[model samples]
Target: MMRIWPVFRRELVGYFATPLAYVFIVIFLFAMGASTFYLGNFYEGRTANLERFFLFHPWLYLFLMPALAMRLWAEEKKTGTIEILMTLPIPAWASVMGKFLAAWAFSGIALALTFPMWITVNILGEPDNGVILASYIGSFFMAGGYLAIGSCLSAATNNQVIAFVVSIVVCFLFTVSGLPLVLQVAQAVLPTPVVSAIASFSFLTRFEAIAEGVIDLRDVIYFASLILLWLGINVALLERARAG
Candidate 1:
């Protein structure tokens, strides 16, 4: 736990040491503002619901989360730091957990910065705070799931660009699985149950429930399990790489 704290502190500080964190926050604010205010027609339509903001998240995270996670292990491997890192007395799982938590917390900060939108909604109309809070919780867990996948992919390669591209592709597949385009394609050939099962695995399917203010236990479990599954895979990959 002590070793984990040092790595977490280092990675958290590392995020602020570069322009990456600033750039990400700025772009994220712009994207959220544009989506909710201009494109979402929140002002003109005067909708109290946060559908517009939540709608844009999967696509936004599909790109931005990968950028945040691309350097996790890829940069270490590329600079020969992984060799030295492995020599430390830290358990592999602790290192993976520490780094993953740091990145997840960083992403959570970016998500929290969008709170102004929630404030705006409350000021404009009688927004349901309960639902809004649930939605925020859902978004945070979803981002963690995406980050776990990105961390795993980053660990598998030394090139940041390759890691970024691969993470984006994998995340994209998860995001689009339940969309009409993908479901339509699946329905054309697969049986009804199979198609339904495929769509059920989508990120959208799980998130949409929370976006609607229904904090179902099953949905929470699904996202938590998704995060843990990928993190376990990440640990295994890093361990294998170190051994090899």
Candidate 2:
């Protein structure tokens, strides 16, 4: 825990030490605001629900979360700092947890910055704050899951651009698995139950429930399990790399 603190601090500080954090925040807010206000017609129609805003999150995170996580291990390896980092007195899992938490928290801040849209809804009408809160929680967990995948991929490569691209591809498939395009493709080659089972693994399927104000325990557990599983893989990859 103590070791984790320093690592967390270091990673968190690293996020703000460059233009990446600010650039990401600005673009995130702009895209979210534009989607909700302009494309979603929230203001023009004066709808109180956050449906439009929440709807855009999966697509938004599909790209943005990977960008946020691309540097976790890839940059370390590219700079030849992976060895130095691994040699620290901290446990590998602790380091992984700390870095994961830092990236997750950064994504949380970006998500939180969308609160003005919430304020807009409340001022327009009586939006359910409970539902809004649940959506935010679900979104954060979804982002964490993506970041965990990115972290593992980043560990497997020494190029940040490659890490970012691979993470985006993997995360895109995860988000779209439940969509008609992917489901249709799966149904053509697989049994009905198998196709349904594969779609059930989609991030969108779980997020839709939360966006609608229902926090199913299964969805929460799924996201948590995803993060843990990917982080475990990330640690193993790094350990293997260290050994080889």
Candidate 3:
């Protein structure tokens, strides 16, 4: 943890040192507001809950997470700073975890900025704040999953654009794995157990389960495992890069 702190702090502070952080925050907040109020019809629903607001989180993170992750290692490699990073005394795993955690925290900040939606719902009517809080937790985990995937993909390539596009495509597959359309396709070529496994990996499914107010241990474990798996791969990719 001590070895990771400097890298984490450097990466996190680097975000606010530029306009990228502000731009991302503004875009994220606006997108959340528009999706919640206009696209989701929060007022027309007449429900006090933030179901509409939380519902859009996965889809929103689809684009936003990749955009954030594309720069993690891609920009470093492109600018040739990755060599400097590689020379640091920190272990590769610590660097990878530090960078991933920094990006995840940045995303959490953006997510937290949407608290007004929660405030608005409370002012309008009594709602299950517990369920809402659970949904927030689920959304944050889901974002971490996306960022982890993107982080690995970013490390795999020097082109940020390729990293962004590939990250989106991979994240899309994970997001839709539980849907009938994807499951149907998988079931055709695969056995029942395999199909079931594919469905279990769906970000939407796990998140929706938690959003329903049940923070099932399985759901938490699933997200944690997914993040760790991808981060492990991310470290391997960086190790390979250093070797080459």
Over all chains combined, what TM-score does candidate 2 have? 0.97
TM-score to native of every candidate shown: 0.96, 0.97, 0.98
Compared with the true structure, all predictions reach lDDT values of 0.90, 0.91, 0.95
lDDT per residue for candidate 2 within 151-201, as digits (tens), equals: 899989999999999999999988999999889988999999999988888
Extract clashing residue pairs from model 2: none
- Model 3, CA-based lDDT: 0.95
Query: What is residue 112's positional error in candidate 3, in angstroms?
Result: 0.7
Q: After superposition, how far is residue 3 of candidate 3 from its true place, in Å?
A: 1.1
* TM-score-better candidate, 1 vs 3: 3
Between candidates 1 and 2, the TM-score winner:
2
Off by over 4 Å in 2: none
* Candidate 3 C-alpha lDDT tens digits along 1-244: 7999998999999899999999999999999999988999989999999999998999999999999999999999999998898898989999899999999999999999999888988999999999999999999999999999999999999999999999999999999999999899988999999999999999999999999999999999999999999999999998787677
Candidate 1 lDDT by residue in tens digits, 38-62: 7777777767878888888888899
**Descending-lDDT candidate ranking:** 3, 2, 1
Model 2 / residue 55 / CA error / Å: 0.2
